[model samples]
Target: MDIDVFYGMCGENHKRLETIEHLFRDCEVSARIWAGLDLGIRVENAKSLNMTDWIIDWVRYLLSREGGVKRVIMFIAILWGLWIVRNKIKFEGLAMNSRVISGLLFESINEKVRTLSDQVDGENLKKCLKGGSGEHIEQKKSEIRDGHPLQMIGNQEQCNVIRVEVDAGWERTYAAAFRWVAYDGTGQECMRRQVRTRAESALQAEALGVRDVLLWAASGGFLHLDISSDCLQLINEIAGVDKEDHLIAGILEEMRGLSSYFHCLCFKFIPRHFNGVAHGLARQALKL
Candidate 1:
């Protein structure tokens, strides 16, 4: 049934049958390969020197004399071979190859993967990126409810301290496979908004990155997360612990209170050069 379900997704009957046969055949072949090696036989070259013909004959010689499932794969290649022959003879067509079948299967799942990519959370960071917070932050936004215009401007100051970059620079490639990855513990339903950016410093980019993640999380049941950044000066300014940097004091306070649902909130500082991948994302975030 599992094969039937996915097999139908392939669309071509001959392709479906071929892929199913190959999948089962490969699974069996791989499972028994080590045993063949231990027996000191070159299974791969069995096609040459008419070895498989004689081997099947020898296997038949054994089947009539003694037997097992090993006999099935060896002597009964005809079970699958027969169907392949019938489709060719009846429909005057060739069977589909494994590669083409895989392409169709993946193509069918690509859009769902994109939707899933948008819903995932918490940066499972790579070693090369720094400065930027998460690799794939929210990319688009939508209004989930009706609210007042006054609420529309709801204190950007009162919002949580989200460091964001302006563009979607080099970070998207790492995020390209995002459609398939899962968001941690959120059970798969996610709402993501696209981000817009201007060329800015890593700190500013990192700022935007944090903003997008939080903005997306706000829509779902997500409320708590300890955002890690490499900007120590910004965190101190945000917490009001570092007083004299008077520029964003109001901005800091507003973001600090943005979350009414979070159990706790935190912003941590990390090193710049060590934050390469995130930094790349931030740099890329600026381009988007």
Candidate 2:
């Protein structure tokens, strides 16, 4: 039998020969996605590790963690997203962004969280999905907010709840930063974070800021959140009052999925002047 030799090429970069490690971990695009996930998995340290052993070791390590099962699920989701993106680029000749995979990962993880039962692993998965810290908080039933401005929680009612204000700083260059400041019931600052990302527009930047705070607050076990943002359009999009722009539709959907994790969640539109603290923080983060 006569056969022709086949050459394997990297689907993402096109210039390099394809190997499991290069396609999944070492490719420039794949490396950025892994870094974005912030899972603490050091791809650089695994230079000498075979792909099989690397996967197995991470699985075992995640299984030993507090939310091992859920973390494992997320890890699998990342791998799945990476594979799909690679296929799209190879077969469909499509250009893909790292954030697209992140959106897919959130959607997949959210769907998986719902099917989990009431077993210990299921509960752990739920906690992990909700961004709950390893703290014990009795689960309570809550419904998604309908986004009625009238239904908005008043400042008086927020006396015992965390009032988290989120804002974004964006430049025409697409460099952006999201900042959130959390205040205790008494209106004293308790927590704050500044994160960097890229966005195409001001509205999209604002949406990303809200999503960032939601994930952080949930992870910190802040079950009841009153999240305020200065971008009224983004708030309206989240509350279903206005149609979300195509640029941020996926992020809005992900935010809605995260809403279920809280005992109560409220979205409030604050004037830019009132949101000065978060706005200033976000701008300052851009310089960092």
Candidate 3:
């Protein structure tokens, strides 16, 4: 049973030797849980490759980039949550903690990518509300009621432009809920919010609901806001055209420093049927 006497010891000299890249990447609790998963690839720079060619060169550099399938399913859910916390610290002796194993590997990869983004947004909102015509699906539900879509931007006029619509509702017990809705410029609804905390993904609860709806529309002094979501990689990582180094990169750098307190912010990607009223108030704030 020589996988170093069936994974016996690796650090603090209890007799170091458990291989498979020393128990999943030079164990000291797997190098502090893969260096607390900032995931720009390390495992001691692929420790002279072996764990299946360092996970096939880190899933081929995250499938050649751009939110590559949610960063290769969050690097295979943090290497299957560090091999189930190294088999629950070697058969239940249990007591490891790289922040509770990277918060249960980002809450089980954000509740399996928010249940596969709600079954591909319920089949793309039933194929964009198929074949319309209940008065054209009530005029495309009054132009997405609030996620804005009537389309006009140069000189405003998508009624007059305000629309917010954010969403989030991850679970796996790290909990998470987030909502936002705003809608003015004729679609009506004016304001809305919802919270609930502790997020570890659903893209960090949609980047903390776009940094709390851009600090509540710049402290209610709102200006031409926009900010939609249905999480197109969190609107392509807040419009810098996608680049996220995991754990929602500090809530997308606090939503790009709250987009300099917007005088005219924007960010869109609607689809969950024009973000169905902020995804039904983020699944009614995760059922309260």
Full-model lDDT, candidate 1: 0.36
lDDT of 2 by residue, 1-288 (tens): 111121122333445446677666766666766776756776867766546446756765786788777677767766766666555556666546556645664565455544442233755544544434433232322224434331232233434678899999889999888899999888899999887777899898898888878777878888778888888788777656677699997666556556666766678788789899999999999888
| Model 1 TM-score (2 dp) | 0.31
lDDT (0-100) at residue 185 of candidate 1? 36
Q: Report the number of clashing residue pairs per model.
A: 47, 2, 0
* Residue 44 displacement in candidate 3 (angstroms): 29
lDDT of 1 by residue, 1-288 (tens): 023333222235334443433332223332243234222233343332222233433433433333332342332342333333334433554344454433433343344445434553323211111222322112111222222110111123343333322222323332310101113333342332344433234334344445445545555545444454556555545443466243333234324334433433345554556455455554454454
> Model 2 clash tally?
2
TM-score, prediction 2: 0.52
For residue 136, give model 1's deviation from the true position in Å.
29
Off-target runs (Cα >4 Å) in candidate 2 are 1-159
Worst 10 residues of 3 by lDDT: 133-142
Model 1 steric clash total: 47
- Can you tell me which runs of candidate 3 are displaced by over 4 Å? 1-159, 165-172, 175-184, 190-203, 208-225, 228-246, 250-264, 267-280, 283-285
- TM-scores of the candidates are 0.31, 0.52, 0.24
The most accurate candidate by TM-score is: 2
